[model samples]
Target chain A: MSLDPQIAEKLLSEMRRGAIVLAVLGQLQREHYGYSLRKNLVDRGLHVEEGTLYPLIRRLEKQGLLTSEWREEDKRRKRFYRLSTDGREIYAQLMHDWQLLNTSIQKTTGRSE
Target chain B: MEIVDSYLIEIGQHLPEDSRQDILAELKVTLEEEIGDRAAQAGVEPDVQHAQAVLQRFGHPLKVASEYRPVRYLIGPDLYPAFLHTLRVLLTIAAVGVVVVSLVAAFAEGWQVGVWSLIDVGVSLLFWILVVTTGVFVAIEYSGERLGWYESWQPRRLASGSLGIIDRGDVMTNLVTEGVFLLWWNNVLVLPNVINGDSGSFVFNLGQVWAAYFWPFNVLVGACFVLHLYVLMKGVWQRPSLVLEIACNTALVAVLIVLVTSPEIVVVANETAGDQSEFLTNLVDRTLRISLLVISGFCVWDMWSAWRHFKGASWRRSSAA
Candidate 1:
């Protein structure tokens, strides 16, 4: 059965949001500019666009989870973003939470026998 | 070729600003390549009309363009929260800036005089420039590209810049002039007393400080020249202003003016008064005088340069407007 476009859009949007949160937490430990971060995410199998990357970087910086500075690279300038101390702590916790959830779901399905 | 090219251009019109060219190029190639595939798949003659219809049925040009692009959000899940947070910080800073300005004016000098001082003039000029520039860019970027609040408005030709001309000689000459003028201003008018000092080193000395005090006009003239050079280099003839560039230049101009011209030098010197050593008083006086001269010169130069550089540029009216 084909799904309605509206329902498909909503479901895909939620999935995308969850993916972004995970992707951001994973790569932000080291500094990366928006373009580099997008490339990194794409390399890791998470396709992201320039629009999404920049605003996300800004948001993360504003939230005290990231810090950024303008740095010279290849004789051009780029703004590099890195995880803050609090961000590192939060990211670790988030990973732990994700693992626990994944294990619990697997066990519940395994027990359905 | 002419008929095929027009068809391709029509499809190009619907693509987003950032990826329009790339997508168009890819589509053109795909059409050329896919013509063979379609002819083979259906076993038809190399009919251009059939190929065109097949491409059309695969999707509308805009829809196909969207599919090729990776998913993006302007005010996406990642950025909206941060944006709201930034808004709070900016509002707080503005409030604090206003209170500080008022307090400084009330306590330092007559309110009316303070209101009309050169410092006040610089601050107001900077404030309006930032507000107006940001507003205009935001409005233009959004409307021109049909971008949503959080969508990226990447222009198609960002790599080469938006200008039609590619004359390197003109740009190089401007930069050389700018750098030379900057070095001259710092070395000469601002440090006259250093040459006059006992050791004759390029550093500051007694006769230099007195000379600096005597030649306040030189400070403004030198500063004006340096500032013009910087404006020519940074704004008029260089790369376009990205978002980060705009933020930095705005903040730098505002902070520099406030720090340089507040008569804070006099205040600091006065605080060091009542010391027993007459030599200390002289040192404080000299330091304040020299610093004020340097700062005033720099400010005047920047203001003059910004005005002059922008006035002469092709985009002068648009930028100023």
Candidate 2:
């Protein structure tokens, strides 16, 4: 069946919100600055845009799910970010809930996981 | 790099002040890094085009800045319906008002002059009304004093008579009316050379008596313009304004008396007329006189009704006190 592109994209975007947050948190576990983080996400087959990444990280930081500090890297100062202690615990629970939800959906839809 | 500089400057304007520099600094790094990556992928050195491409991907300055800030509406949803209704009524009236004024202009001057009048009245009316409406709404939104508006319920108000409060729509109408009249009197619009009719048209000029009241008319219109402007800004009529309104009406009555009583209101110059000059002049003069008489009646009636309304408003206030 054919679907309208705008509706399809909008559906995908709504679905991506939690996934994007998870990706950012999971990726930030490995200490990357804004550009490197965005690059890594794009490289990982996730379609994160340039405008979407920084604000998400800042919001995550405000929510106590991320920590950042400015330090030198490759002879340039960059704000490197990683999951905070609370962030690590929260991410673990979120991952657990995410996996459970995923398994439930797959079972309910009769899709092979 | 200039493109990047301009982009950052634009973004900085819209960013929240407390975190502006930090946001700009981080954005700058990401932008420059993105450009370098694109350049590397394309096997070229980073340049202005690379910066331009990166900034373009990041989107408009306001869009980018908005992402970092909490969303806000200038006129929030609570007030939106009222705002929309106000705009609808005002703009509809304005559209009709400008066409009517332009028709009057076309009758007095030429059709080309009427077109100019249309454009002049349209721009001034629509632009100022929108600005004033938006400004007023924005002020209300920011003040937050209107929190009561959300809680207040008055079903009776929907069916009640006039509350004597000034209607913003009426104020806007008066403001635009006075403004357009001022523009017409000042000869702000250029007049094109009108082609005379097949039989040729008469050049009708008012007699010296009318010419003598030129500045007086100008000053009179100017004062009315200023008074209405003041009333619009204040959003209510105080005793002083009511007095000023009566004074302006009194002066307008005197001017109308002089204009209508004049023996030679519109005389056709024979040099500019065809063979049927006398007949055309008489026809034109009578029309002019009739128009003046109609206008005088309208003005006097308007003044009378307004004074009566204000007098009622005064009694209401004093009795309430």
Candidate 3:
């Protein structure tokens, strides 16, 4: 069976929310500010929008899942965000969820072979 | 330097007052740092134009403005779908309410309940449905589903750099225009400024007692609106503590009823002119009066909700400890 390109794209976009959060958590194990974080994620081929990234950063901070502080770097203060203690716990759980999801997907797709 | 400074100011103008200077400082530092790097790469001396270009590459005023803003959803993400569902339910209920009331009124009048009655019922139903649906859509679209809608939705979040710095100049102008129309059509300006005291006016009006003449009243009204705008921008009003919200809303309804119904009974004779019926005019007058009262009531509710949000944040912090 074949899917229309637009439909497939929309479906992929809709399912990417969880993937984005997981990616953010994994990357934020090391502190990175907004632009650098975006660049790192994109460098890894994960495309996140600036509009999406800033808000997500704030939300993660507010939820106590991420800790952030502004520090002077090369004459400019940049807000560096990293995983909080709670965020570490959350990251671990999310990693478990991801592995389960990944295995389930692999099993279903593998069965087709 | 001039161009970079102006651009930074423009960006700062869109940020919350508390964080405006800090953000501007950061932006300046960022521009300087980035432009220095770019100039080094190009082997050209760093200049104003070069910094401007780099800032331009970063994004425009609106784009940069948005980065510092809380996530806004029309119906807000967390409870918007639920709000939409509830709105549908409310509209259905309001439609049924209008029909039943109109029917009862028609039958009580001992009329045969003719075509005009049917038309009246239809118009009432259509009017409320249109109103409720438009309101729900606006609330949802402006405040609804978004990833960070809830993060800055609290009342104190009104002071947050992201949601707070929004320049509502365009909206304020529009509101002033609407307010002028409301004042003119209602003959509200003609009413005396005296609060619950008699003035040498031709007629005593109940609306005059609770009129929006006083500055404090205006301030309270303005605060309610600001709170509403804060909620709309932050997108938390949709999924706020369900019980607390419902109770606040119910209290508003009760206040509105009292404000409206009181004028009808208390200041009956003063509600009319020679040919004009006091009861009818008073009913219309009181409705508007009650709406203002309810608005102020909601402001008080916003205060409560703000306290709750602060408590929740504090609780979270303490529990983590």
Q: Candidate 1's residue-wise lDDT over B268-294, tens digit each?
A: 222222333344445655666666566
DockQ scores of all models, one per candidate: 0.01, 0.54, 0.17
Write model 3 residue lDDT over B114-223, tens digit each, in one string.
Answer: 44554575577667776777576666566633335456567864533221221234323323333332333233323332222132222444545445434433443333
Worst 10 residues of 3 chain A by lDDT: A49-58
Q: Tell the DockQ for candidate 2.
A: 0.54
Note the Cα lDDT for every prediction shown: 0.51, 0.76, 0.60
True-contact fraction in model 2 equals 0.64
The parts of candidate 1 lying over 4 Å away from their true place are A111-113, B1-321
- Sorted on TM-score, best first, the list reads 2, 3, 1
Q: Which stretches of candidate 3 lie over 4 Å from their true place?
A: A1-17, A42-47, A111-113, B1-32, B46-60, B72-121, B129-321
- Check candidate 2 and list the clashing pairs: none
In DockQ, how does model 1 score against the reference complex?
0.01
Tens-place lDDT digits, model 2, residues A54-89: 888998998998999988877777888999999999
Clashes in model 1: which pairs?
A: B74-B150, B74-B151, B75-B150, B193-B208, B219-B297, B223-B297, B223-B301, B224-B301, B227-B302, B228-B305
Ranking by lDDT: 2, 3, 1
Per-residue lDDT of candidate 2, residues B172-194 (tens digit): 66556655565555454334322
Best by TM-score: 2
**Clashes per candidate (backbone, < 3 Å):** 10, 0, 17
Q: Between the candidate structures 2 and 3, which one is better when assessed by lDDT?
A: 2
